[model samples]
Target: MSKKSFTLSKIATLCAVALSTSAFAEQAKDKDIERVSVYGQHHKNYITEQADSASKLGITIKETPQSISVVSRALMDDFSLDDINAVLESTPGVTVEQIETDRTYFKARGFDITNFQVDGLGIPQDGGDVHGTLDTSIYDRIEIVRGANGIMTGAGTPAATVNMVLKKPTYTTQASASASVGSWNKNRLEVDVSGALTDNHAMRAVVTKQRSDSYLDRYATDLTLGYIAYEGQLTDSTKVSVNYIRQSKDADSPLWGALPLFYDDGTATDFDVSTSTAADWSYWNNDNEHIFVELEQSLGTSWFIRARYAHMTNEQDSELFYVYGTPSAETGLGLTGYASEYDYKDQQNLYDLYATGDFSLFGQTHNLVFGVSSADMNYQDSSLYDYTTGNGFPAMPPLEDFEGNAPIPTLEDAYNGSKVEADQKSAYASARFKITEPLAILAGGRYTEWDSEGLSYGNSKVNSSEEFIPYIGAVYDFAENYTVYASYTETFAPQSEQDQTGMALDPITGESKELGIKAQLLDGQLFATFAIFDALQDGIALPDTALSTPDNTVYYAAEGINSDGYELELSGRLTDDLSASFSYSHVDIEAGDDANEGKLVRDYTPEDQVKVALNYQVPVIEGLSFGANYRWQAKTSRVQSNGTIPTVTTQGAYGLLDLVATYQVTERISATFNVNNVTDEKYLHSLYWAQGYYGAPRHYAFSINWQL
Candidate 1:
C-alpha cells in the first residue's frame, strides 16, 4: 500500500477499534467503567481553576502572582481556532506577527516570547519564532503566563510562557468525527478516538487525524496525531505512568517569505488577498515525536516523591522559494528568486526528580517543595542552495504578469550552504511557602549552560554562555474574594545575530516587575485581573546601518530598553447561560540610554489593543447557542530603508469581527456555522518585516460533528 493509504488505514483501524470498545462499554456495568468528567476538557467554560506555567508549584491562577490567560477547548471549537496563531490572537496582551504564511513570531510586553512548553515540559527553540503550524485539535487547553518565567523555563525572554496541555484518554471509550467546508475551496476533516484500552482503565489511547485546505493561494496541509498512555496502581503508595505522542504535518505550496510592500522608488505596493510568493513546487514538512515516563510514591498523606523523564524529537524538511528586491511601480522589473532546500533536526532529553510535603515550621504549617530538573537538547541543520545562476539569483518576470511559474533551479552541483550543530542544557528548582493564612511567597532560581558552534553560508560561528536566573513573588489575600500580588523575575536570551565585526552579539538579559490585583466572583466562576508591568532589557539586538554585510544584515546591542504596560482582563461565566472574555492592554516601549534613545522600540506592535468574546445559550430555543468575537488594535508604523532611501510603512487601526452559531441536531450530533472577518476588512496581516501579506477577507465555514 502507498504511504498515504497506509496512514488512512491506520486511522480507520483505530477508529473502528474505538467504536467497538465504545459499544462494549455501553453494555458494561456503569460502575465498572469510570466516568470521567469533561468539565475541564470539553465543557463550555472560558477559565480554568488552576495553572502552573509560571511556577511549578501547581498553584491556582489567583495565587500564581503573574498574568495568566487560558484558551479553553470550547472557545477553540466555537470559533474554529484550529491554529496556534488564532488561539494566541484571541488571548490578551499577545501579538501574533505573521511574517510569512508559515513563519510566525509571538510577542508580549515588547519582548519576544521564546518559552514554549508541552504539558509543563520545555520545548525551547533556537530563536523566538515558530516555523510550522501547530494544530489545536490535540490540545485540551492552552495556558499563557505573561512576564518572566525563569523559575520554570530557565534561560529565555521575559515576555511570556505558553503551556499547551494535550488531550488525554478517558476511562470510558469515546469517539468523535467532524467534517467542514469553507470559503476559498477550503475543506477539512478530523477524527478523534480516545478511551481505555484495558478493562481496568490502566491503558488508554488517543488518536487524531486532520486534513485541511487554506484560504491562501496554493496552500494545503495534512496532519496525523497519535497518543498512548499507560497508568497503573502498582501498590497502595506507588503509582506509575508512561505516555508517547507522535505528530506530523505536511504543507504544500507554502510561502517561504512574503511580498515586498514597497517599490524601488519608495512607493507602497498593493496586492490582492490571494497573492502568494510561493512557487507551485514549494513545500514544508515537519514531524514531532515524544515519550514521557513518571513514577510517584506517596510517603504519607501530605507528601510525595516523584520522578519524570521525557524525550522529544523534532525534524523538518523543506524546499522553498524566496522573492527579494523591490519592483518598479511602473514596470515591475526588479524582482528575483532564490531557491533553497533545508533539513533540520532537534532532539531533547529531560529529567526531573522532585519531592513535596507540608512541614511545621515556626508554629505555622508551611508548604515546601525541593527538586531538581535537567534538560539537554541538541540541534542540527543543513541547507543546499542553488548557485547556478550567472547574476547570482534567477530573475523573475514582471510583477504585473507574474504567476508562481518561477524556474525550479537545480541544487545538486551548486550547493554552498551546509551544516550546523548546537546544544543547550539547564537545571532548575523552585519552592512555595505559606507564611500565613492570608499570605504566600514563592521563590526559585535556575542555572543554565548553552553553547553552539556552526557554519552557515560560509560563515563559522561559536557562542557559549552560563548564567543563573532568580525569581520571587508574593500574594496576599486582603478580602474574601480579592487578592493583591507582586512579582520580580529576570530573563536571559541568547542571540545569533552578528554585529558589524561579524561577531555574534552577547546574550540579552533583563528584569521584569509586576503588580496586580485579582478577584474571583460569582461563586468562583468569574476571574478578573488588572495589572501594571515594567521591564528593562540590555544587550537587545538592533539593526545597524553604519556597516553592512553581503546579505544586507548587521546588528548591534542596544541597552536600557524599557517597556511599560498595563492590562485589564475578565474571563468566565457571567450567568448560567452566558460566558464572556474581555481584555484591554496599553504599552509604551522606548530606548532609555542607547544610541536610539527616546525612539520607539518595536513599534510594529500596537500601543493599545482590545479583545472581546461572548457566548450565549438561547433559553427559548433549546440546544441553540450564539457566539461573537471582536478584536481591535491601534495604529502601528515601522521605518524601513528602501535601497538607499528611508521610507515608512504604516497600518491604521482596524478591528475584525467573527460570529458563530450552533444547533444540536440530535443527542449525539451537532452542527456549527462560523463567519470570520465579517466586515471583509482589508488589512496587512503583520508589519514585523518589510515584506508583508494581506489578511484573509470574509470567509465562512460549516461543520458537522458526531460523537459517541
Candidate 2:
C-alpha cells in the first residue's frame, strides 16, 4: 500500500474511535441520575442531566443576564491550581498584577475590580493587594459575574465580581490526599474528607499545608489552612448549614526598589542599575478566619425564605525596606548604600446578616432581598528605625540602629515621624423583579461613612471628611443563550488635608456607566461576553502640588478623571478523555483630570491580555493525560513620581507555555509531572515605576496522590 493511503486509513480509524467514545460519554451523562433538593421550596426532583440543578436554580451561565463564568472543581483538579491567582489565570476578563510576593492587584473591563463574594456574601475591598493572595483549596467552584454587581453586592465598582463556593458534605463517605514537590524546594500537602455523620447530618473537613523556597534567593513561604462544615435537614421544609475557615501564612520577600530612568545628560536608559537588589529585606505574616451559617425554609407553596449570617476577621503585619544607591556617577545617587525600614499592622472585623424571599405578585414572581451589614477596619503604622549606611554595609542587619554606631542620622535623632488610625461603617438593600419569563430588572443602593486622623513628621495633625455613595443596575435576558445589561455604580476613597491647618476635605468618589452583551452556549459549557464602559470622577483626590518634596510626598488634594474600554470571555468543557478551557481579555484604560492637568496616567494596567489551556488524555494509554497553557499581554507605559512624561517601560508582548502529564497506577494512586514556562521565555510578569519583576523561569514539579 502507498504511504498516503496508509495514513488516510489510520486517520479514518482514529476519527471513528473518537466519535464512538464521544457518543458513549454522552449516553453515560444522560443515564446518570441523582436526587436534588430545591432550596426555598419543599420539592424533591430527579436530576438526570449534569447541569439540570444549576439551570433550575437560575445559576447557569445562559440564565444569568449579566456576563458570567463558572470554573468547576473538576477543572481545578485537572490543572493542579493551588491559589486564587492560578485559578484566575484561566478566567476571562480578569488580569492580575503582582505588586510583590504577598501583594497583587486585579482589573476587569479596563477598571480595577473591587467586588468579591463568598457564597453570595459581600467582601469589602480594602485594596487589591490581599485579595489575590487568597488560597483556592477552600473553594469547590468559582463564579465570575461581570459588570456592576451593586444590585447583588451593594456598594462596589462596575468592573466585575468574583464569588467562591465552598464544598459541602454529601451522603456518601469519601476522602482524598495529595502531595507534591516542585522546583525551588517547593512542597505541598492537602487532605479533604466528607461524609454523613448521621442519617440526617453531614460534615466536611479540609486541611492544606505548603512550604516553598521561591525562585528568588532568600525568599520563602509557609502556609496552613483548615476548613470545617456541617449541614442538617431540620425538617421536610427546612434546612440549615454552618461553615468555618482559618488560614495563616508566613512569607519573607523584599519589596524590591525601582530603578532610575535617566543619566546626568537627561537621556533615558543611560544608566544601568543592578536588576537584583539584596539590600532590601521584608516579611509578611497574616491570619484570617470566618464563620458563616445559612438557613432555608418553605413557608407555603408560593413563599420561600433564606437567611444568612457571617462574621469574618483578618489581621496582617509586614515590614518594608527601602534602598537608595547608584550604579553610575552620571545617573545613580552616587551613594554606596542607604536603607530605611517601615512597619505596619492592619486588622478588619466584618459582620453580615441578610434574608431573601420569593413571592407571587400579580401572577409574576418577585424576588426581594433586604439586609443590614457593618464593618470596622483599624490600621496602625509606625516607623521603627531610619538610618543611612555607606560603602560596606553589613548583611541582614537588624532594623534598629544604635545612635553612636549609625553613620547617618537615626529616625529618633532626626525627629522624623509616622501616622495611624482609619475606620468606616456601611448599610444597604436590593431587590429583583421578574417582569416576565425572559426579562428581569434589579436596583439597589448603599450608604458609607468614614473618618481618619494622623500626624506627620513636622508636628502636623491631619483629618478626613465623611461621604455617602449610591449605585444602580439593570439586566435583560433576550433568550436562554443571550443577555444585555447596563449599570451605574460608585465608590469612594478618603483624602488627606493639604497643610497642618486641621482642615478636612471631602472624599474622592468615582462613578461608572456600562453596557454589555453576554452569550452562553454548548449547553452551558462555553461562555463569552463583550462590554463597553465609561467611568468618571468629578473631584478625584490626588497629591497636593505645593508640598512636593524630592520624593513627591504630598497629600491627596488634587483632582482627576478615568475612562476605559473592555472585552472578556470564559469557556470550558468536561469529557471522558479530553477537557479544556480558555480565557482572553483586552482593556484600554486611560486617566485625565485637573489634578495633573489630565496628562499623567497610571503605570500598571495593560491593553491586551490572553490565556489559554488544553488537557487531553492519551488514547492508547488508559491512565495518562497531558495539558498545556499559554499567557500573553501587550505593552503598557509607566508614569514617574512627578506625573510628567511617561517612560517606555514596556514588557513586550510575550507568552508562557506550561506542560503537565499525569498517570494513574491504580484507583487510589496517581503520579503527575508539571513543567511551567516550558519554552524558557524571558519575560516580566509585572513592571512598576520603571522597574521590572521577572516572571518565573522554566521549572518542573512532580506529585503523587492517594485516595480512599
Candidate 3:
C-alpha cells in the first residue's frame, strides 16, 4: 500500500479505538477494586494514600504548562529497557542518532537537546566528541520537559531538558535479580537490593553487567555499572542522604566513516564491499563516576528546605583508523583504499551545589530555588601515519581488483594536536504562588558565567561569556475536574570571546506562549490535556560572511527567527484492568533574517513527529501481559558536498512492533520473552547526509527474574 494509504488506515484504526468504549468499559468492570484504584485517576490527587513521588513532593505536573513526559519504573521493567536510547526512542518529539554502538546524539522540537540532570542537578549534555553513554540500571524514573528551560537549568537552548531520578534507599526491605539472553550472543544480568539498616538508617545498591555481539560484523560491546546509596534521619524533621555511582564500557569497534555518497551526476559510487577499513581497533574504555549528597528539612506548618551537592568525572582513551584513496602512478587519479590512524584522550570533571525552599506568604504558597556550579573539562588529540607498502591500508586486498600500487606515507610527516578547557558558574531561582483556590502563578530566572581556553598547534586562545533568562506561567481551575493554563518563557545561549568578536552580541533568546485545556475524566481514573502554542526566538546570531579566507575564516552575524506549532498530551487508566499512555507533537518551523528575508531551515529538524505505546494485562492470566509501540516522522534536510541537497532523508516513517509475555513458575521466580522489531523493517532510526545506518533487525530475548 502507498504511504498515504497506510497512514490514513492507521489513523482510522486509532480513531475507531478512541471512539469505541463498550469493550474497554466491560473489561474494566471485571477487574478487582485493588487494581482499579491504581489506574483510574486521570489526574493525581494529593489526598491519595499512594500519591506519585513528584506529587508527594508538592510538585505539580498537570499545571506546569510545559510539554513533559514521565517514564515510570513500572513501565521500564515492563519494557526491559537496557539503554537510554531504548527508553527515549518511544517518547514523542524526541529523536536519537547513534554514531557508534555506545555513542548517540539526541534532538527534540527540531533542535539538539544538550541539557541533562541527575536527581535535578545539571550535568553536561554533550560529554564531548567521545560518546557519553550512561547505564540505565540506577534510575528510578526519567522526566523530559520541553522548551526553554534556562529558568530551571541555567544556560541552554530552548529545545528540551532530561532529568533522571536516581534510585534511593527505602524504609522497606526488598531485593530482585534478573538475567537475560538475546540474539547476536547478547547476555545481561542486573541486581537491586534495598532495606533499612536501622530505625533511622536505610541503604540500597544496584549492579549490572552486559555483553553483546552486535548484528554488524566486527562489532561487540561489554558494559558494567554499580550504584549504592545511604539515607539517615538526622532529626525528627530532617533527613540526609548520600549516593555513589560508577559505570564503564568496552567496545571492539567504533564507527569512524560513513557510507559513500553518489557521484557528481547523482550516480552512486561502489566502494569496497568486503575489505574492512577498520583494522585492529579497540577502546581502552570510558568511565563515569559520581557522588552526591542531599539534605531535606521541614519547618513546622508551611515551610520546607532542600539542599544538595554533587561531583562527577568522566575519562576516555581510544585509538581510531580512517580510510582514504591511493593514486595510480600512471593516471594520477587515485583508487579508494584505507587511510590513517589517530590516538585520542580526554577527561572532564563537574561540581554543583544548590538549595530550594517552600514557604507560605499570607495565605498562599511560594517556592524558591538557587544554585552554583562549575566544570573543568579537557581534550587532547594526536595523529600518526604509516610508511610500509600497505601499513595504513587494510592488510587484505580490495574487494575488487585494482590496477594501482601506492606507497604509504610516514606518521611523522603528517601530524596534528589540540587541547581545550572550559569552566562555568551559575545561579537560578523559581517561585510558584497559589493566588486563589483555583488559580496559580509561576515565575523564575537564572544567570550563568562561562570561560573557555584552547591551545592547538602551539597557538592559544581564551574566551568568556554570560547570560540571564526568565519565565512566567499561570493556570486557572475552571471546574472541579478541568483547568486552563498559559505561559511565557525566554532562553539564552552564551557567546564565547574566542568564537565571537568583542562586538557585545546580544544573547539568542525566545518566548514561548501557550494556552491549553485539561480534563479529569473516568472518576479521576483518567487524565487528558491538550494545548496550542506559538513559540518565537528573536535576535538569533548567524554567520556574517558567506566566503572563506586564507588568514581569517569569514564569520558572519545576523538575527534569525523561528516560530513553532505545539501540542502536549497525557492519558492513562487510574482504575481500569488495562492502563496506557500516549503523546504527539507537530511543529511548523521557519527562519527569517533581520531584514525579514525568509528561508527554509535545513539539516537540523523534521516538521512532524509522533510516538505511541499501549500495554495490557490479560484478565485470565495473572502474570501474563502484552505491549507495543509505534513511531513515525516526516523527512528533514541534510547538507551534502555539492551545496545543500534535499535528497538524503531519514527512513521514511517506519513502524516497530514488539511483543512480550511473562509467566510465574514459582513464588520467587518468573520468566519473560520479548520480541523486538517483529516485522524486521530495514529502516534508519537516524540519517546524516546520504549515508544512513540501518536500525536493528528482528531480535528475540528471554529473561528470568528471582526475588528474595
- Which candidate should be chosen as best, given lDDT against the real structure? 1
Q: Cα RMSDs of all predictions?
A: 9.8, 14.3, 12.2
- Quantify how close model 1 is to the true structure by its C-alpha RMSD in Å: 9.8
State the lDDT of candidate 2 residue by residue for 27-143, as single tens digits. Answer: 323222222322111001100111211111223343334556666675576567788877776677677766556666666665556766777765546454552168888887777
Residues 1-708, candidate 1: write the lDDT tens digits: 232332323543543454344322233222121112122221276666556677655467777789999898789888999889999999999999998877899989987788888878775566688878787877889999998888778778778999988776566777888888888666677676766655444555555566667767777787887777777777888988888888888888888888888887887888777788787888899898999888988654555667888998889999888889888878888888888887788888887666554555554444444455666666667677767654226787765566677777665545555355555555455666778889988887876666677766665557776678988889999998899999998988877778877788888889999999998777766778999999878887777877875666788888767888999998878887888899999989978566363254457889999999999999999999999999999998778777688778888999999999999999999999999999999999888877888898999999998888
Runs in model 3 deviating more than 4 A are 1-57, 124-132, 261-277, 280-284, 323-355, 370-390, 393-418, 456-461, 497-507, 536-547, 561-563, 593-604, 637-639, 642-650
Candidate 2 has an lDDT of 0.59
lDDT of 3 by residue, 492-540 (tens): 6554312234343455566666678877777766667776766655564
- Candidate 2 residues lying further than 4 Å off, grouped into runs, are 1-65, 120-123, 152-155, 233-242, 256-275, 279-282, 293-320, 329-343, 386-425, 451-480, 496-503, 547-559, 574-579, 593-603, 639-647
Clashes of each: 0, 0, 20
Residue 46, model 1: lDDT of 67
> What's the lDDT for all of these models?
0.78, 0.59, 0.61
Better of 2 and 3 by TM-score: 3
TM agreement with the true structure for every prediction: 0.88, 0.78, 0.82
Clashing pairs in 2: none
Native-to-model Cα distance after best TM-score fit, residue 263 in candidate 3, in Å: 4.9
